[model samples]
Target chain A: MIERFQYDNRIVKNFLFVTIMWGVVGMLVGLTAAIQLVVPSWNFADWGSFGRLRPLHTNAVIFAFVGNAIFAGAYYSLQRLLKARMYSDMLGKIHFWGWQLIIVSAVITLPLGMTTGKEYAELEWPIDIAITLIWVVFGINMMGTIIKRRERHLYVAIWFYIATWVTVAMLHIVNSIELPISMTKSYSWYAGVQDALVQWWYGHNAVAFFLTTPFLGLMYYFLPKAANRPVYSYKLSIIHFWSLIFLYIWAGPHHLLYSALPEWAQSLGTVFSIMLIAPSWGGMLNGLLTLRGAWDRVREDPVLKFFVVAVTCYGMATLEGPLLSLKSINAIAHFTDWIIAHVHIGGIGWNGFMIFGMVYWLVPRMYGTKLHSVKLANAHFWLGTLGIILYAVPLYFAGFFQSLMWKQFTPDGFLMYPNFLGHTAGDQDGLRTARYRR
Target chain B: MDTLLEIKTAYVLRVIGGSVYLTGAFLMVYNVRKTVISGKLIANEDAEAPPLEKMDQAKESGHWHRWIERRPIQMLVISLIVVGIGGVLEIVPTFLVKTNIPTISSVKPYTPLELHGRDIYVREGCYTCHSQMVRPFRSETERYGEYAKAGEFVYDHPFQWGSKRTGPDLLRVGGKYPDSWHYYHMYDPTSMSPGSLMPPYMHMFEDLLDTTTTKRKIEAMRTMGVPYAADFPAHANDHLSAQQDKIVASLKKDGIEAQKEMEIIAVIAYLQRVGTDIKAKEVVEAKPANP
Candidate 1:
């Protein structure tokens, strides 16, 4: 006998609300960091300096905003795909509250200057332990739902979800190994060249698995649903998933190019990173193709507009990723505002747009009402798209302008931008102006 | 003649392997298309457990991928292995090979004061803005001094080779600026470098250097195999005091008060020490045995 159960929209609804709340907070912090960069006086508190708050901005945007977005979409879709409610509501609630508590701890501790100093992995020992525990709760809850599924075959989205959980759990555990000196402080297990290698491996993969893969899973589900079309190709998605996971791991070393990382590892990183363009673009094509017969709807619909820009930005960023990995390009671009443009393309354009679209799509349905304002939604889509273009394009130009100036030797081998005007303040003024326009 | 024949056979085998792989993939696509076309998807298909005896007798679950998908724990464990393989393969070999980190004999370990200062630097997230590793690029070397050697950072506990540089690289900043300059700059970055975006660390001035963990930190670094003096942990306070006295005198000369073992004094000692030890190689290389 088969007994039907209601899909647990309540848990999904909770995660969705918190995702929007935290996203605003995270963006506010990021805005402050940008402002602090332009107006140094904006560094108000002892802990409010760009150096300190930068990590907070990253952690908030990544773990809080994007992280909760993943949980919301995954939870909502996982039930529908598997044809079962989450295994245990109690476990789901535990996972929810535990994650928020950890975020709260990061807010208190990070500004107080208790950091591990590893980018993206900045949360200290205690918070790291809490993240591990909550992640396990999430994993168990997810697996339980999967195993007892009424569906015979798991969808491509579920596969991406599985890869996401397994890979993120592995990355988190390995990178967070540390020797503690105090309750709140610890040192990374690896040091110097080795540490840089490990941190980037974890760091780059954090961007891959956390920000990219889960959102791709969200796209796989939500795009097809919204467009009222079947996926463009299933076989292409399989190849995209497997190849991306395998190749993305080797590409981590590319971030350390021209640095102290050994030549062999660096070369391996470059080759694989170049190879990555194939699968990354294949996935992008797969996503955009899903909207094929619905092009007219894309123009009228705010949801599809967000997605159209998201997939296009994903394409732009992935192509640039390989270009940046090339040793020559990395040399010119690594420390410049060019890199800032490249990342924000993905950060704001891809992840930010996707989550915004997903949230807008979810809210009305969960509340069982029509959208309050289609005009407002369209306005948002245009403004966001324009802002990203305006913000990113100048920075790209400024990045090249800055690097060329910095490295330019006069015929006599004297520095060209010796006065520090064009390189620092002038280009940064371009960046700040772009930030304000946003 | 035999080598040429072997090479030809190898080439033939490669072609055969490629063809076989393509044939298998094509067959899989054909089979999948047929199955999907034959029936619509059953979104909530009712599944029942087969008899245990039959399941035991069936060594294989008829459909291999289906079997794995059904058992979520088994799938998760397999996924773990897949992910773990890359990290293990890359990292383990690097650790086993000591030559990966070149040795610099002149690079002495950090003093207690310098260690605390380094800790303070880590705490303040200075590495976020300023990278300590100077790359071999012409622009970087011309700007930051000597290109960083792997050996120079072997003693670095958590590696300060930061990925980004919003500010200038500080790997070789030691001795470039006077003690007073560091004092005023940390107190207020704008006061020193006009139009600089760095924040004021005046709070570090107000806070006392927390020496309570100095011994524990020295012990931790020693455990990491940094060569500290014998009885370093027990005598950490004495060593820090001696170092502090010198810094205090220097700051007094420059009129900054060096204020009762504040965090800035310790950070100053550390900044002064960055990339300075390798300069001793000239003297170490000149030494006679037992000197």
Candidate 2:
């Protein structure tokens, strides 16, 4: 018996292309939604309203853009790391096409108002089933490759990948259990408080495992390669991976704080969320320190600079996340533009920048040429940085403004801004208008 | 040598760093343009890293293998435990514990027409932005109304306990308006509340009421422990008709002629029932004073 390296780069390439395409689409949708906050007219009366388009933007970015990136990196790195070809190239293609199809269905249906009425887990049952099937296909291909690997032990990245797959599958299936009222309509099996708990549990971890962990896995792989250095601390990665996953699952309830969710769960969520800063920064530190000797390279290399900024942004977002989870802070942040600022900081600054860096590094290697224009790559970085700054700072101010106005009381004990619309119309209008122009 | 010295000088270093940063920034913008227009990568090459095996085989075996192999099962079990813990905490307190959700004697189930209206409200995803449950906090009670009690929602199959506060909570909407007022509000929200963000549901008025699903819905609710009569589906129509007459009379009082089968009437019926159940308790508590 002979071992051979027969991994399919084509699938990896397809996923990468889709990731970039959907990244742009998701970002544009996000930008549109952001603008709609300022210019409400842009939200036409029909399916394109803020309520409907908001979910579309989220689903496109998280599932279509980031999800594809996860698969792209996983397939590319997993094959070589395992020293084996994917279990089946056919399964890989099916998984790719199926995922893209699911994204397409989401794109169509969400705009058409076909939803389960759950945030993040809004896709109808048919598409939900498609997602489950495709996920299974992806899992089978992943597990088969692992089992048949020429190497015996799995690396830290593989552990993160395993956690990502298993946790996301559990999250998706559990949250999607609904009784169908129509082809595209369904009611959650667990209603009311139970439904809220289950949703944020799925929702928060969708951010955790789906968004954070897989990207952490990417960081583990790409950051080192870009810097021409080994990871600074293996022990830290171990601690970081486990603690992050376990703690991340429990922190979903923080999103529902001061609401109808039980007080104990809310407190539990807040505690774990606060604890998350340690492990999150540990991973960030590891990535940053990996470039300890390569800071000179970072000055010259566009790829390293992107990774540097991305890791720093991850650190900032992770730290801010814990702060925002606190009850007092969340009281002000929830349902405000502050939450918006926090999310985009993570999405555009951390995830977007890292993906850009990876594309810069990977595209050149894959195409067997030096970059056509380093100048262009540099330009994209600054514009993106500026866009992120322009996007987040005003929103943060707006969030505080909204929260203060909504909570403000006069000497007579009447609400300063008695109506919700008054709060929205105040500082938020300026922020929304600015975002719209962008 | 002097050129190297020039490059190493502070001004030269600053210029180099600045240009590199500028160049990197420019590349990002150009890349976006190129990506949009030609849809081409600046570079594409075959990946040169040794295939995955060489990397994997070089790692330490025993600890890593056990950790990786056990991860999936570990994550699944842990996630289940977390969910189960939260579930048990929520369910056990609500069900087994005697004092979990204090009962309010005045709280009663909705009338048949109101129940139908509540279902419509849910189907329209009103709770996506509006909450019906108010906690015993000053902010909530002041903003909405009296704090919500568990018994008020006893008959709710899936409680409309909304999460987001995109709109104000509707927990105490009962008696806030006349039957006709609700009709006009739902038809065109701006007419009732100026500067309202709520989308107009004029289509609800245009779309014929679907009574076909009423029986199945009742059956489903009954299965979910809603206290309904054994022959509730058989009497659903009679109950609906009687309730429709009352709503029509109320609407007529406000100079609005509403058909018995109109969706607006059903929605109005639901709106009127919201805080009414809790008001009954207050009336009972005040009965001693009257006597």
Q: Identify the candidate with maximal TM-score.
A: 1
State the lDDT of candidate 1 residue by residue for B12-89, as single tens digits.
Answer: 333333233223223323433343344443323232432223333434554445565455676567766766776776
lDDT of 2 by residue, A22-101 (tens): 97677667656544543445666557766677788889988998899899889878876777778898999899999999
- Docking quality class, candidate 1: incorrect
User: In model 1, what are the clashing residue pairs, if there are any?
Assistant: A192-B159
Clashes of each: 1, 35
Looking at model 1 chain A, report the run of 10 residues with the lowest lDDT sum: A425-434
The superposed Cα distance between candidate 2 and the true structure at residue A9, in angstroms, equals 1.4
Alpha carbon deviation, residue B150, candidate 1 (Å): 0.9
lDDT of 1 at A324: 98
| Residue A430, candidate 2: alpha-carbon lDDT | 27
* Tens-place lDDT digits, model 2, residues B1-291: 121122123222222332333344345545644443444432222223343344345544545535544334454455455444543453445445545345556665566778778766755656556777676666557666787765565565456666555567788888866677778777766565554556677665776667776776666666665667899977887888888889889889878877888887889888888867878777888999999
Using DockQ, give the best candidate's number: 1
